[model samples]
Target chain A: MTAVPDAIDQALGIAPGSPLHALRALRPEFVSGAEACRAAVLDPEETLDLSPELRRAIARRVVAGAGHDRLTEGYPRPADPALAALADGEMPEDFALAALARHADLIAETPAKAGPEHLSALQEAGFSVPQIIALSELLAFACYQIRVVHGLGLLKETRA
Target chain B: MTDTIPQVTLKPLTWTPHLPPVEIEDATPRQLEAMKVTPSAKKVSPYVRTLAHDPDSYVARTVLFNAIMYAEGGLNRADRELGALGASLINGCKYCANVHARQHARLTGTATTSALYAGRRDALNPRDAAIMDFAEALTATPPTAEQSHVEALRAQGMEDAEIQDLIHSIAIFGWANRLMHPLGHSD
Candidate 1:
């Protein structure tokens, strides 16, 4: 029986065994930030029993991670009216650029080299201590995978 | 919060080609000015701006529009408002919550919005409650929602077209809520 954090209990409505709970069980030092983010972004099935504040916190974390470079990358770069129309007034150029830049940085940062700045950002965004730890752990794992992939030239190959 | 009760007035809006116009002739001058000030009051993101061209054509407004216009038996404005509120609540979108809740309060009165914000879906009348429940399930766990959910709404006297519109409203808000949540705070 794992002791679940109160915030997780409050946000998700269900007790432990929730996806968020699984995320919490992993130790932060053992994992990495990028991995956690990748999982959160790619795994749509993952349920987050996030409170309004926590949800805002996650959004803030993603936003902060998305540095200024990513913020300005507009969709269709030069500008495609059709894509813009499909954006349906949702995707703005500046916002896209910012998000892209941040995601790139997060992907570039090494897990072993990560510092308090990363943790502090999540904390300021309203992540419970447990969630912060879990995210860090996941990020470490992601970074490890990235390193392996980069070494093998797998990432570049896949991109090509 | 002022405990002093503000006088409640009913001002029905009629739909126009571009947006629905709020006729506030019965509202106090202050209230009317406040309404006019809402759009220009803040610098909105490109996302929000595109959704709301006029005061009445907001994303939530468009959702309600489609719901009322295309629903089978047709949903009343109040039901559409409640649906928006329920979806916003499920998505955990404070901005949408603020917007939809205010509209709900304006149309259905403060008491109703109070009950909803308090998380008391059962307290609402059966019809409205069903709509809220359906909207919540749809937004929170879309794939898991079953046919019975739609059937339950139909049993409550909603038409197929109305249910389709309701589903569309829920789906649309799911996307809109995510966009707003992530981007709303930004300049």
Candidate 2:
């Protein structure tokens, strides 16, 4: 049975039956696990107070900030101007969205520099505990996805 | 908890979460299900409990992480640990680095870990250095890993499958370091 390619394969342009696709096929668990993770982060079964639109905007913001433009290319621009600002790398004027954007940049760029104060800031901005955890996962997943995508792109170049 | 944050070290460290973790007694059924895969059979650590606040993502993360680091075949276990250690080192995730350093040491020896902790990549053997170099490049924002990095691993006799495994090891830590570093401090 031919296994369908997951999001990572699509992002890296790894065509079916190609050498790189076969290389990925060697680790089916990693490929499937990654896609599952993408779903959990991007469109969770329970989003709590964090909406799916906001999550996508945050994902785009972080990935774009990380310079993996390809990852954000497929998502249509958010209809909400505030979310559009976020996807464009501008901090929204809303207190909570601004805090999320700031934290997203910190996690994507210099995570080691983050501290208790950052979490406190999120709390003060009215993010519930679950929401904060969800946002962290979102930021983290974006960073992970970019690294995987970029790493695979390099591998593709190597084989080309 | 002191106000100070810990620096990167090979010594094992304690991680203190900035947010209060969900108490086990207060955990929901879903949270408990996700916590199943976490190292919480005895006493749940603050890190695992903190992650449990978001159950679905926590579950997905644990599955993906295990698949990347512990899946057999392709890269051997030791080099996968080394790849994780290298990425953790570059990302400055002290807790993750300390954990993987011990794993790498247990699997191999402490020479490469010591060299990495001491900022002495030159001290690593050719294969170790190549892995470290590739990990560092791939860990960089925008990821500077090149075809030459792949060729270097190839020169070390790593197959494409093995190299992909190594890449997953390093890349997952990019995910892990973001969470572990930002959500807490190691001391």
Candidate that scores best on lDDT: 2
For candidate 1 chain B, the 10 contiguous residues with the lowest summed lDDT are B13-22
lDDT of 2 by residue, B1-187 (tens): 1222223335679999988898988888898878873444747889999999999899999999999988877799999998898888778898998899999888887777777776666667899989988999988886889888889999999987888989999999999998898888889
Off by over 4 Å in 2: A1-4, A157-160, B1-10, B37-42
Docking quality tier of model 2: medium
Residue-by-residue lDDT tens digits, candidate 2, A36-119:
898898888888878788889998888775565557774456999999998889979998889888888888888878888999
Error of 1 at B87 (Å): 1.3
Give the 10-residue window scoring lowest on summed lDDT in candidate 2 chain B: B1-10
Q: What does DockQ give for each predicted structure?
A: 0.02, 0.66
Each candidate structure's TM-score, on Cα atoms with residue i matched to residue i, is 0.38, 0.93
lDDT per residue (tens digit) for residues A1-160 in model 1: 2353332223223346544334323322112222223334323122233222322222323322222222112112223443232223232354432332233244223212233354345445555433333232222222222221111121111110
